[model samples]
Target: MYLYPLLIVIAASSYGIVSTIIKLAMQSGFSVSQAVTSQFFFGFCIAICIFIFTNRTKLSFNGVKTLIFAGVFTGLTNIFYGLSLNYLPASLAVVLLFQFTWIGMLISCITKRKFPSRIELISLIILVAGTIPAAGLIHVDLSQLPFQGWLWGLAAALCYSLFLFVNGRATTNMNTSNRLVMVSFFALMMAVFFQSPEVIWNGTLFSEGLWIYGLALGLFGLIIPVYLFTIAVPKVGLSMSSILGATELPIAVMVSVILLNENITSLQMGGIVIIILGMSLPTILNRNMLSITKKSTTLGTK
Candidate 1:
């Protein structure tokens, strides 16, 4: 039980650190395409290595196509997000990316043909309200923010939500490592398509220690989290997984503040707290419902 929760934390923490690392890599002269492509490439390599090392017996091809399709979203999510950072501040970009939380809930509700629960509705309200400040848009001048940046951020959120929805339904019982290899392979292919050939062949990505940054990004941003979440999500369930996943936002903000010298005001901090509260609400409600069910059963038995 604790192990599942711990895996969620590790996955979320790895994801949280990725944006800041990408920012750092950019500051060190890595282009957005270079950063995105290299990360996926390395992620594919690492996943392949792990798949071979652990599951050398035989490979299962079940649900390979669905996993590959999910990989397309995975690739797009990284591309949109990494490019969004080019025109947006890292802090605000991460907050925008966090919109996936509510978006994911909406996707679930629609797919299941059910309205959101009272707790979910309340959570969405709080999430939207908190996003204004958490994104530092409350007092900041709007004219300064690029329209393209916002578009890219929202696109990233949409694709990410779709990815989660698809991933939840795809290849549930397949070998985790093999599934990751296929997913990573397709993700890498998509990254290559979006990436300029000159950047790959011209040795541009090989300079300025970009490979090292790419290795780190691949490990944290793609490889580790996907592996852990693949294992944890089935056990803990999506609502709990999402609540735990909210750990990414604060961890991202903290990393930006500490490593990138980004600043957040008291008001923004308040908003961040609210966002965290919204994310946790669903999981808390789920737990209470379960407890009540158990209690009712016990009482009936008496």
Candidate 2:
């Protein structure tokens, strides 16, 4: 029970670190195209390798198509998120993206045509409350930013939620590598549509040595999260997976402060604590009962 949720946390942590990686790549004179598209390009290449080795179960044409379509949710999430940053401050954009935590819960409700449990509801509120400060948007002047930025930001949020929802159900029992390969290929196609493939065709990958960042981003950003979520979300439920996914923001803030030497206010630190608490809320009570049951079993065996 605990193992699956922890996998989602690990996946979310992988996501949190990508921002720091992107910043480091950009500072090293990499273009946005190189910094961003390398993730998909190398990710697709690596997934192909994995699929070659682990090609046991073959997917039907419909299943392959399903994953390809599902892949668009993540691709659009990144595209919209990038667009939002053009017109809004990074802080504002992140806060808006954080809306996915609740939006995911809303999606869970709509799909199941039911309400979330009491604990899940409370946890959702706490997570949303934490997000405003955790993203450092406590004092945003949204009145000045262009309206299109907000639209894009919210669109990113929705797409991210949908990404989790769709991927959770898309051919879960099929070949893991098959699903991974299909998703990565389409996502790479989407990236190429919006950005240039000059990183490959122009020989920038070797000449500028962008492979280092691309390799890291490929593993951390694309492969790890998608693989883990595909395995865990179906078992843990989308609402809980989304809650665990909120850990990304707090970890991103920590990485920014510790690795990037970015300063965080005391309020932001407090919000980080709140976000962690909220993330743990749904699991903590059940885990305590699990502990007691284990102890009782131990006594019975003795």
Candidate 3:
């Protein structure tokens, strides 16, 4: 029962480091277009390889169209996220992107025409509260930051939320590899249509061997998360999955600390603890629900 939620957590944790890697690529003089395109280009390459070896059920025409459409959200989210990294600090940018936690629940309520359950409401509030300090935003002066960063970051959040919503609802019965290749192919196309700069077409990637970054990005950022989420999201409903995805931010913080050797404030550590607690709410509730159901089943049989 908890397996799907655990998959979401694993996928999110792996994806959390993508921003740090993208930032490293940018600081190495790769353009956003180069980084985004290279990431998705290689992602599609991997997807195709997986699709070839994996057994896939024949898909309907409408399913193909829907997966293609869903791919756009994935592409836009990554592209805009790369753009955001250009202006904001990675921590701040991630915090902004995580605004999707609330945005996702709101989208669910609006589309389903029903309010979120009490546990979801409580988790949402806790996650938001924890998110602020986890990014160390309490120490930064937000007023000094450029408006464009906020705009792009929030836009990424919207796209990311939509991507999650779409993944949870669309053609889940299809084979995992089939959905991955279709979504990844269209996402690569979308990235290219965003108009990659000269770097993508030039020797910058091949000569300098920045293709290594693309390899890592493709494997870690796209391939792992996309494959896992495709399997997980349909099993776990949107609200629970959204909450589970909050693990990314804390995991990102830990990655920055370990890999980037960045300093973490005391407040940020506290926030990480709070975020973990917030993430645990659904799991606790689920366990209780399972126990209750088991008890009731025993009573009925008696």
Instruction: Using lDDT, give the best candidate's number.
Output: 3
Assess the local accuracy of residue 5 in candidate 2 as a C-alpha lDDT between 0 and 100.
Answer: 97
TM-score for each candidate, following the candidate numbering: 0.90, 0.89, 0.94
Instruction: Output the TM-score of candidate 1.
Output: 0.90
What value does the lDDT take at residue 130 in candidate 2? 84
lDDT agreement with native, every candidate: 0.79, 0.82, 0.86
What is the model-wide C-alpha lDDT for candidate 2? Answer: 0.82
Clashes of 2: 0
- Write down the RMSD of all candidates, one decimal each: 2.3, 3.2, 1.9
Per-residue alpha-carbon lDDT of candidate 1 for residues 1-302, written as tens digits (9 for 90 to 100): 36886788788788889898888888887788888888887898899899889986566778887888778988998899988999998777887788787787777777777776787678778777777776576766768889999999889888877776666664845788988887788888998788743565677667657788788889998898888877787676554565567667877877788988888788879988987887677767777898999999999999
Q: On residues 252-302, what C-alpha lDDT tens digit does candidate 3 reach at each position?
A: 999989878899989999999999999999789878999999999999999
- Cα miss at 239, model 3 (Å)? 0.9
Clashing pairs in 3: none
- Candidate 1 Cα outliers beyond 4 Å, as residue runs: 1-6, 197-201, 234-244
Ordered from best to worst TM-score, the candidate numbers read 3, 1, 2
